[model samples]
Each structure stands twice: as structure tokens, then as C-alpha cells.
Target: MPSRTEAKGVEAISSDGNLSTVHAQTSRKERPPVDSQDGWNGTLQQSEAMAPVYDWGPEIQGIILSSCNYASFLVPIPTGYIAGIFGAKYLVGVNLLLSSVLALLIPLAADAGVLSITVLRIAQGIAQVMVFTSQFSLWVKWAPPLEKNQLINIAISGHLMGSFITLLIGGFLCQTKVWPSIFYIFGGIGCAYSFLWFLLVYDDPIHHQFISAGEKEYIVCSLAQQGCSPGWSLPIKAMIKSLPLWGILVFHFTEFWIFNILVAYLPTYINSVLQANFRDSGILSALLLGAACIGTILGGLLVDFLHSRKIFRLVTIRKLSTAIGVLVPSVVFVSLHWVRFSFSASMGLLALSSVTSTFCQTGALVNILDIAPRYTSFLQGLSEVFAYSSGAISSTVAGFLISQDSEFGWRNVFLIAVSINMSGLVFYLIFGQAKVQDWATEQMFTQL
Candidate 1:
């Protein structure tokens, strides 16, 4: 079973494998993906499963799958600086090319035994970050404002789908001794995506000739209302000082910590602790992720509905979601200590906890865009940094805690996760608000 970090940044379709809210600058020579028919608009028009090009056969598909996992590890480290300084186009281009190159190296690295499994994992992690970040950045550039939520959901769903397919089908493939075929398949797909991406994708809508004038007008108007500039640098200080940014960071950190622990380690926990079979573990893992997929879409719809009705502000909606979402799972974690049930019953409790907690994950992701539309990508990257960092910590700590037990003992780990979830909820309620920052407002006024 892959760790949560392997599934990191699996939620949103932002350039960083997380949610980022930023405006894309455009030039006539460089059109953004949103503007092209094959961009976000085109993608969302189809089913979420087939939205991204994840169907390039088993080997390449597995590479893309692993790449998705790998990117979750790599995105946060370099995404913010790259997007902030170089702009989204170069960021996307460099990342796409780099990820493909590095991914192809995995086979060679393995055959030569030049690196340990851990080091090879790290390399895959780096490639995952680059590829997803680039893909997300391009999506942000091309996707229209009104469709942002749905499009982002679809984009992120690709990862969920990937995980689901891998678990369900990967085992069979491996049983057939075609395991290496997975990586080879993904490598070939990566090369193909690079070629098509270079030819079809642009930096912004204004530069794309294929986009009609009416479509551009609709996009511009929608973005304006969402606090985005069509093609300008963001007010860096305002974004830096925003309270919502910090709120999002904390929220995402907590959500990812729980998610990472479960997704990465749950299989082992079930097998080692509950003494479940491999098939059972795989099924439970898929259910956990499937719950997350459902939670993400439902959470988005709920938040969007609330925002539309003006019943609560976006920030308040996010807070409410986080509180309810985190609170439920924290209670479940505590209950786990008392439950003397069969393994199936335990799995039921865990799956329920996962489904509810996932609401917080989607909420925090959408909030990144809500709070800082101008620098959504960079801010999200910042949040990813913290989220993934927590994931690394959780991974190491969970391993240590579980190892200390002679038998199936995960009580300490659950207690720790419960504490983290509760703390995140409290922090969010106390400090998180969706309104634009005072400094950002001032900066906007000054610019005007």
C-alpha cells in the first residue's frame, strides 16, 4: 500500500495537486489551457473519470498513477517559488518536461540497483510533484471561473480514480508478473501527454485564437467577480498578510495529516493489527478513497450552494464544514479505543470516519481559492508544503507508534490523530474568515 504522501495533492486540480486560486496572465503568442477547447472547459464537459488522460494503457497508466503519487510529494517544495517568480507557463512547461524525463529514469534506476528503494521512492515523489503542478497550473489558466469548482473537482478526481483502479486491477496485473509493465505504460503516456500538451496548451485565454470572443468575455467577467485579474501579477504583500491564507494552511495541514495516515498506513494496520487478508485490505482501502471522492464532490456542491444563496460567506461555510467534518472523525477515533468488534466492524467504523473527515479536506482545498483568488496557486502550494510536511511527520510517527506494539495495537496512533483533528477544528473556527484581507483591499484600492 502506498502512503498518504503517495496520494497527496489528490483532491484538487490546481497546478500543485492542491487547490490554488490565482489569475493567469496571457499573451497573444501563448494561450492558456482554459481557453483552448481541450483545456479545463473541454475536460469538464466530459465525465470525471475520463477527464484527464489517465487511460494510456496499464504500464503508462501505472506510471501516471505513480507519478500522481510522486507529485503529491514534490509539488509543495518548489511550486510556490516557481509560480510566483517565473509565471504559470514556464512553470507548467518545465514541470511537464522534467517529470517525463525523471519518470523514464525509474526503470534504469531500478535495474542498476544504483539507489535504494527509499531513494527511488523519493525520485518518484519529485516527478509526481512536477507533473501534477504543471498540469494544474495549466488547468487554472484555461478553466473559466463559473466552472472552476466542478473542473477542479474533476481534475482531482483523476487521482482518486487512479488509486481506485490501481488497487482493484493492479493486484491482478502484478499476479500475472506484468508489474513492471505499469511503469513502462505510464512512461510512454507521459511522453505522449508532453507532446500533446506542448501543441495544444496556452498560458491564458486572451492569447488563444480558438476561444471565441464571447467566451473570453464570459471568462473575464466571471473571474473579475471572483477577485482575479486576467493577466497581471498578484499583490504579493496582500496575499502574504491574508488571515484566510493562514486559516487554509492550518486546515489543510490537519486534513492531510489524517488522510495521509489512513491512506498510506491503513492497509498495513488492517493486515497487521486486525489480521485481515490482502484482498480485504485492498477493498477497505478502496472504500476509504471512494468515500473521499464522494465527500469532495458533495462538499463542493454544498459550499457552492451556500455561497450562491448568500446564507453564509465562503469562509464561514468552510469553517462550518471543517468543524463538522473533523469533529465526527475525532469522535470515531476515540470510540475505536472502546470498540471490541470483529475486523469487519472495525473496518466499517474506519470507513465511516474517512468519509466524514474527507469533507474537511475538500473544504480546505476550495477555501484556498476563495481566500486568495489572485495568488491561489502559490498560496495553495504554501499550504501543500505544510500539509505534506505534516504528512511526513504523521507517516514517521505512525510507523514508530505501531512498531512499538507487539500485537495489533494502534490505540496510541488513533489518539494522536484525534488530538490533531480537534486542534485543527478549534484553530479554524477561531481565526478563519473568508473575507479579503485588509491589506489586500488596501493594495487593490491603491492600484485603482
Candidate 2:
């Protein structure tokens, strides 16, 4: 796999759209509220000073714009469960290919109609979830407990780095005067990556034609007691009843609420708060993600170091990581507006928040593997259902508050974030267990 994996959301693209506004007035044909049979040239007016040429007000505009998250909200558990049953190889590869193709076709879809683009994005969302749903399943066969933090962190860091580079490059691409170049570049990369995925990666190392025997032996031996593979049956009721699982699920919801606002609206937030230009907004966004990428790797290493040395229980380390990640960011966020008096101070503060928040990768994010390696993939899928839902609503919530209360808008958003984090932290501290659940590994349990 490439060191960086590209994951672009429609909301991200929409939020990052043309930062420069037209000061010049022109006699132009305004687009319909919802495009139907609009030509590609008509879809985006290169001269239109504001965002997308679509004339829909923010209300109903939510339909086509947000279709991806709504669709993504529907399929995670089933996709995750299926990936657990079948090997992750085809699931990950085929879906990535499908998503890339959809991405390339999005411009054409926009030309067709608002409905056309909405349908395509919905399909892309479903396909991308299949790719995401397969990730933990791959780790089940490949990663040992001791190596779990570093390995998973390294693999997922690709997501962070990809977004960092994408923001930087996307900003540069915006300057090229070719509006569609970003889509073409990333879509092409996704296609190439998918092809390479099929050629080089496998569900398990043992299945790979090119793997050395010693490496396979090491992986299998390391995972022996931990039960490296998944089974056919699932204890759904037990999972529902588990408080620790709920801890992570709640954590996922709140975490998504907090961080997604950054991903989806950071450029706008920077533009509004700091009065920065698009290029400046892009640079700061990239810097935030770069910090997160570095911090994820370092946080993983720190976690493993403490656990390996017996300085604390793995569970204790997880708690500490979660606490710092949530609390520090909450503090900074509460003061988000006050600090904006200085651009350098604000950027420094945001970078700090981003770095600390990646510790969740070492904390609640990895706790699924700890408590239920057998059900990690399926559970992850289930967790992300909550995650994507919160992520989906987060932007709407922020946009609404911002629009309605211009003076207190961002402050309200930050306070809401702080409030959610504090509550989630309490729940997780009380119930977030690191040991494998009894139902996850028991052999005498009746199959449902």
C-alpha cells in the first residue's frame, strides 16, 4: 500500500471550493435551484465569485450535498461482517476501484443533474465504506498485540498524510486554473493504487506468494494466543450489552463531532476567523493534518513503549491517551475565539490541538482490537456507523449555528465540542476496558 491513502469527502471539496470571490459584476444566467440537464460548462461558472453555481438555498441544498454521508450511514455493519467472512483482499481492492471510477465520473454526473451527482456520490460512499470496513480485518491476520499500535498507526497514518498532501496539492491545483484537476489526479491515483493492491497485498501474509516463511511464522506465532483470525459466528447480543463497546461507540460519535468540523470547515473557519485568504487557509489546514500525521505515529510509539516496559497496564495507557487527547483540545477549543487575535498564536494552538487529538488512535481507536480482536472488523464497522452519522451532522450543526448567530456562532460550536468531549471522556474512563471480552473468545457459547 502507498504510505498515504487518499480519502476525500464531498463535504471537504464543497467546503474548500473557490476561496476567491468575484468583485466584478456581469450579466450572467443564474443556474436553477437544482440542476437538471445542465451542461458541464454550466455546472460551474468559473467567473462566479461565490461557491458552487447551484442556486439552491442552504436548506434543500442539503439533499444532494449530503447524500454521501447519508448513504455511508446505511452499510457499515453488513460490509464489515461480510469482510470478516470473506477475505479482505477483494473487498478492499474492488471497492476502491469502484470508488475511484465514481470519483472520475462525478463531473459528468454534475452535468447530468443534481440527482445524477447525488446518486453517484451515494454509490461512491457505499463503495468507500467497503474499503474502510476491510481495514481492521486485514490487521487481525497481520498484527501482533505488541506491534498493534505502531502497525495500525502506520497504516492509518496514510489517511492523515494523504489528506495533508491533498490539501497542499489541492490548493496548488486550484491555482492551475483547471477546476477538475484535483479530482482527476486523485481519482487516477486511486485507480493505480487499487491495481497495485490486487498485485501486492493479500488478506493474510501466509496467502501471499512473495512472503518469506520466517515472517509468516513470526506473525502466526505472535497472534497465536490472541486468536489471529475471525470466526463464522458473532455474539451480537453480548456485544450490545457490553458497556465497554458502548464506551467506544459513544467515543466515536463525539470524536467525529469534534474532528470532522475541522476537516470539513477548517478552511472556512480560518477564512472567517482569521480573515486569511484561500491559500493561507489551505496552508494552515495542511499544517494541522501534517501535525496529526506525525503525532499519530509518535503517539503509537509512546503507547507501545509504556506498555512494553510495564510502566502501566495497557488499559491505563489507553485511558491516559484518551484523557490528554480530549481534554487538551477541549481547553484550546474553548478559547478558540479569544486566541484568534493573533494568527500565529491561533495556528500554533490549532496545531497543538491536532497533535494531541491523534492520541485517540493510541487510545479508544485501538481499544476495539484489545477487547475483541475476533470481532474487530465487524465492530469497527458498527462503531463507524455512529461515527459517520455524527460526522455527517457535525457540519450541518456548525453551519447552522454559524449562520444563525454570527457573533457567537463559532464560539457555540467550540463549546458544544467541549461539552461532548467531557461527557464522552467520563463514560470511557468508567467503562472502556482493554481486556478481551469473555464472549469474544469463549468456545462453549451457542451459535446464533
Candidate 3:
């Protein structure tokens, strides 16, 4: 199975607007026929090199693939507003449906050439941004205070799992005669899940058809105490002026820079530097992400446990986890260059970096709920604009930085990533907020 890292790399290609080099190969020599009397298989195998059929070159490929990330810069903010006004269930459902359809159409788009595929990827990016905005919007209505980190962390961890499953399975599938099956299988699964989501999930507990009466009442009463209610305007002016909000944006942006570098290029690093074959590269990449999944779950549990016991104040815990999660990884990432001669050791360090770094899922990610549960979705959306934008830049930037494919080029990329990660941590440590903002409640509006 391909690793989650490889899956993430693939997603980076699709979502972040990076072009994977498609080698255009010459026709393969015909294979010797198997003898019918020898009990050999009779089926003719398709050559793996026959796929990737187009070689648009780096320049054209980058322009086309990057449409997804560039289009993302326009979608999340508006989608968040739409989700807030119209409710998230339908928005999420529609986004899923669109993404699924786009996935299924990739082969056809590729056949039609670069422009067609680029347009399709742009549409998919639009759908993806809406999906994230709407999902976080749903959290505004659904997550209870005590369980906030746990719920959000678990939900986010599912992304890790999805990445893991896709990369692993896709790796094996890519080596098969039917490489296109990777898209068909995953897209079909997404379509099926969308149907289930529509049927089983509700916008809020109040409207849920199957939620127990007691549980619904408990949820309503809990939210009421925290001044969570519909009809609150999205405090646009306040959000713009808030230092803490900007802190979150910085945190998100810097964090994703490192993330983009890894997801988009880790497999390439393993292949080019470590000299691992395609299959091994995929497996090693998956192991790194699998470590991240573990870290996510453990980090969430640690936060919730500390919160429950009041072992540390909420702000303290958030900051501490962010430091531990982010800083260690930055250090490990820099140190990776020194150990390049030992492939197994380098892989181990990479996995450790991923594991420790994922604790941020429980830190700043859930911090949105802490400070502005009412506008968690909007806040997350706003931050994601910066994050995805940085993600896009990182891909382009990495391409330029590593153009030489030398150790010097790769080292510079890691150093830049490390520097960004540390800077974000410092910024957030100084300015990050955990207290619920006054603007989240009715009193602030009354004053307005």
C-alpha cells in the first residue's frame, strides 16, 4: 500500500496546484507470448509507462494544475458566508457531489488535454473550499463545549485516515494494468458517502430527525449558556480588527507551508535522494502520515484531559501543545539534511517529525471553537484563505528553490519551511487568544 504521505503528495498535485512531472515514454517492445500448454497466464499486460500520456512540460503543467489553488483564494470567504446564511448541510452535500463528479471526469479531461483538465481542477478546487467552509460551519451548531476538541480532532483525523487509505491503495492500483481505477474507486466511494451524509447528518441537533429528546435539550441548554444562538451577524469589522484572529491566521498560514512542502514533495525526496523505488517511496511516505494520525489522536486526548482536570488553563495548554507539536518538527526537519546518508534513519526522523507536528490539530485548530464558536466556520474559512494561499506559494516556491535537484536545493527548502514554522509559533505564542471573544455574544451586537 502507498503511504499517507504519498496520498497527500497526490492530493497536493490535485488540490494545491502543483504539476507532477509526467514522463512521456516511447512505445514499449512487445512482450513474449506465454505458451498455452505451460499453464501460463494468457492476458496481455498493459505497460505502466503508457500512462501519464501527456507531457505538457513543467511550465504548462504548473499553470494548469495551479488553477485549483489560485481559484481557492476566491471561494472560502464567500462560501463561509453562504454556509452561515443558508446552513451547511446542503452546501457540504453539494460540494461533495461536485468533487466526486470531478474526480470521475479526470480521465476524460486529461484525454481532452491540459486546458480541459485545468478547468476541471479549478471547479474541483471551488468545491473543496466550499466543503471545508461548510463542514466547519456545521461545527458551530453541533459541537458542545466540553467535547469540542475531541470532536473536531476526530473529524480532522479522518482526513489523515482518508489520505492513508487512498495513497496506500492508489499506489498498488497505479502499478496495475488499470491505473485509472484509482480515480474511479475513490470517486465512487466519495459519491456513496455523500448520499449517506445527506441522509444521516443534520445541520443542527434541533433539526435532527433521530437525535434523542434529552440529548437535544442538553445541547440547546449548553449552547444557550454560552450565548450561542442564531440571528447573530458575522462580526466582520471586529474580526478584521482583532489581533488574536490575525494570530490564528498567521498560525494557519505558517503551519500549512511546512505541510505543503511535505505532502507535495516528500515522495520525490525519498525517490530522488534516498534512491527508493516508486513502491517503497509510497510506503515510507504512508508511514510518516500514519505517525501523524497517532499524534493527532493522542494530542486531542491530552488537551481534553488537561481541560477536564484544570491542570493548566486553556490558553496555556493550547500554547504548550502548539510549541511541542510545531517546534519539534521544525527542528527535526532541519536535522534531516544531516542524516541523508542513512536512508532508514532519515525516514525514521521524517516519521517522528510528522507525528509530533500533527498535535497542532488539537491546538490552534480547535482554538477557533474556543474563541468564537458562533463564528468558528467563518474564522476557519478566513484563516484557510491565507493557509491555502501560502500552500500555493510554497509549491511554486519549492519548485524554484529545488529546481537544481541537488542537496543544496533541498536543504534550502527544508530551512525555509523550518523558519516559517518557528515564526508562526512565536507569533501565536505572543498573540494567540483562547478566551471567547465578546463579539461572539449578543452584548457586543447590542453595543454596536
Candidate 4:
């Protein structure tokens, strides 16, 4: 009997090597292997080089696979606050170190048993939370307003490209007969990255000795008028009352819901529905995510161009980009149900969705930096909670639905994701704003 280490295989580490998200089933069908296009059964067969096969049912599988996110939910708020008070530099570096070390140990932990692997993954998740929140915290001072979209999207695109490397390279690695090399190689790279980060990354342009005086002055002056940095005190009451904050939160939830669904279930869909093998599923997922990486860079450039040129108000830009991200994906997902019989068609739709959804990278995502740079880190933490909740809920729900009936289960998942996404778009369009809020200014908080 294979232990729960099989569940660890479900984790998808982000490209930067700093974050990991749970999704996918590595279990192949055992006994009578179900026909690829028909149903799913846990595969209990594997060569000695690969990890042991486990027959975890959908319920247990969902629980163990998503355990990392459970820990992620607990860390973001406090860490984000701390990072604001102290600095994100040490927080991010330390978290990445922990995550990298743990990745190297996964194989040994799997050999130990279920408890070890679960605990290790949870630890890694906590690290992931800090890495995410810290970046948003640093961006409070590190990124000038004009460069917000391009800089942030480019940074995030690193993670996507890393994911592309992980998936595509992982497929080839699996074929090498030494599966654990996947962890050893990536973990080593992450460790190496930590050194580069400590050496190169600064909390702000003001602190970087290598930057030119003119550039630093430009960066500082552009940001001088805004109260976007983390403060000693937050306007909790005002923030709670603000529709724009709520709008960003709701939009984050919606975006995460759809993204998480794809993250957690795409491989299962490919295996059970499309009948593709593990390697093929990974290659396809990697390819689609690569498209998203490209889309993110392009969208950021487009959004910034429009904003810089004064062609649209910041609010209008957000709403327009967000509409494309939401409505297009919804349509594609719905179309998926109709065209699912054709494997190539389904992949193409998913690829399209992957690219279109990235427009929100500039929309709701960058909106926080615009409206309240002061609390961007904390808000990102708040949003992380929402993001993790949606992912956890959606992954479990997906498991339940798929268990009831494989075909209809997927249809329900897509429809549910689409409906939730649409409502978020509506709320954001009505309430989301981009101009700096009065309460976000240092004077307003001090006066209050």
C-alpha cells in the first residue's frame, strides 16, 4: 500500500521556486484501468524509480492535496503586517530559504509516511504566503506608479515561466527513471536564487547604492505625493467602508476561484476526460501557462500605455480589462462542455482562457497599488485569504462533483466557476476605483 506521499505529487510549485499551489492527481488507475475518456480510478502500479502508487479516493485526495493551502490561509495576515512594520527583505528571504530546503526533503519525507509529507507541505505553504505578501509589501516603495503594471506583471510572469519549466521539465524528468531528481534540481536552483535575492533585491530604490541619483530621485518624486507605503496605523474603519477595497477583494476571489479550479483539476480532466497520459497533460498545462505568461507582459504594456497616454481613466481601464478577463473565460469554459469530445478543441479553448484571464493582472490586481499603496501588502494578505479560500473550496467541490458523476461533475465545475466569476465582474465594474483614496493618504489617517 502506498502512503499519502502520493498526494505530494499534486503540488505545483510556482516558477520563481518560492511558491507552491496544490492541484492535479498523480494517481493512475489500478485493477481495470478505466478508459481514458470515461472515468477515473486510482492507479496502484508504478516502476521502482517512481514513488509508490496510492489509491486515495476523491475525498481523501482533495483533503491531503489541499492541506498546504490550509496552512497558507493562516500565515498571510500576520506576516503581511509584520513585513509592513519591519521590512519585506528578511521575511521574503527567510521564507524562500525554508521553502527551498523543504522541497529537497520531500522524497525522504514521503519515505517516512503520510504525516511527514503533510507537515512538510504545510510548512512550504506557509512560506509561499510570505513570499507572495512580501512582494506586494515591497512594491509599496519599490515600484513607481508608472511602472506598476509592467513591473508587477513581469515579476509574476517569472512564476508562470517557472511553472512552465516545472511542468515541461518535470515530464522529461519523469521519463529519466529518477523522479526525485525533479525535486533535487529545482530545490538546488531555489537555494541558489535565495543568494541572488539577498545580493540584488532592495526594499526600495532609495536604498540601492548602484542606482543613479537621477533615477532614484525620479522614482521617489513620483511616489512622494501618494501615501501608499505601509503605515504605523491603518484606517480600518474607512477601509471596511470602502467599496473599492471590497471590489478588489471580490474580484480576487473570483479570479482565484477559476484559476484554482484549473490548477487543481486540469490534470484529472486530461487523464479521465481526454485520456492523455501524465506527461502529455503536463506538457499541455505548461504550454497554456506559458501563453498566460506572454499575455501578462503584453497586457501590462497595453494597460500602462493607455494610462500613460490618457486615453482612458484608470477606472475605465480596470473595468475594461477585467471584463475581457471574466467574460471571455466564461464563454470559453462553457464552450468547453460542448466541444470536449474533441481533445484538441478542448486544449485550444483552455489555452485561450489562460491568455485572456491574464488581463486582470493589470486590472483588479494593479488597482490596489493605485488606490492604496500604503496598505497594498496588508490588502494583498487579505486577498490571499480570499484566494486560498476559493481555491480550497473549489478544489473540494470539484472532487465531490466529479465523484458523483465524472462527466456532469466537470460541467458543474465549469458552470459554477463561470457564474461566480460573472458576479464578481459585475460588482467590480460598479464599485472598483483607481484614483488614490483620501483615506489612503498619510494626512487623513494622522488627522483621524
**Best of the candidates, lDDT:** 4
Q: Write the per-residue lDDT of candidate 1 for residues 358-406, one digit (tens) a residue.
A: 5674466666555555555666667777676676667656656655673
What would you estimate as the lDDT of candidate 1?
0.53
In model 2, how large is the Cα lDDT of residue 297? Answer: 83
| lDDT digits (tens) for residues 209-240 of candidate 3 | 77678877877777778765543476777877
Ranking of predictions according to lDDT: 4, 2, 3, 1
Q: How much is 304 displaced in model 1, in angstroms?
A: 1.9
Judging by lDDT, tell me the better candidate of 1 and 4. 4
Q: Between candidates 1 and 3, name the one with more favorable lDDT.
A: 3
Residue 34 Cα positional deviation in candidate 1, in Å, after optimal superposition: 54
Q: Give me the displacement of residue 364 in model 1, in angstroms.
A: 2.4
Q: Where is the poorest 10-residue window by lDDT in model 2?
A: 19-28
lDDT of 3: 0.68
lDDT of 1 at 107: 47
Off by over 4 Å in 4: 1-25, 30-50, 446-448
**lDDT tens digits, residue span 75-159, model 2:** 8888888888887888888888888877778756755767887688778878877777787788887877787898788766777
Q: In model 3, how many backbone clashes occur?
A: 3
The CA lDDT at 119 in model 4 is 80
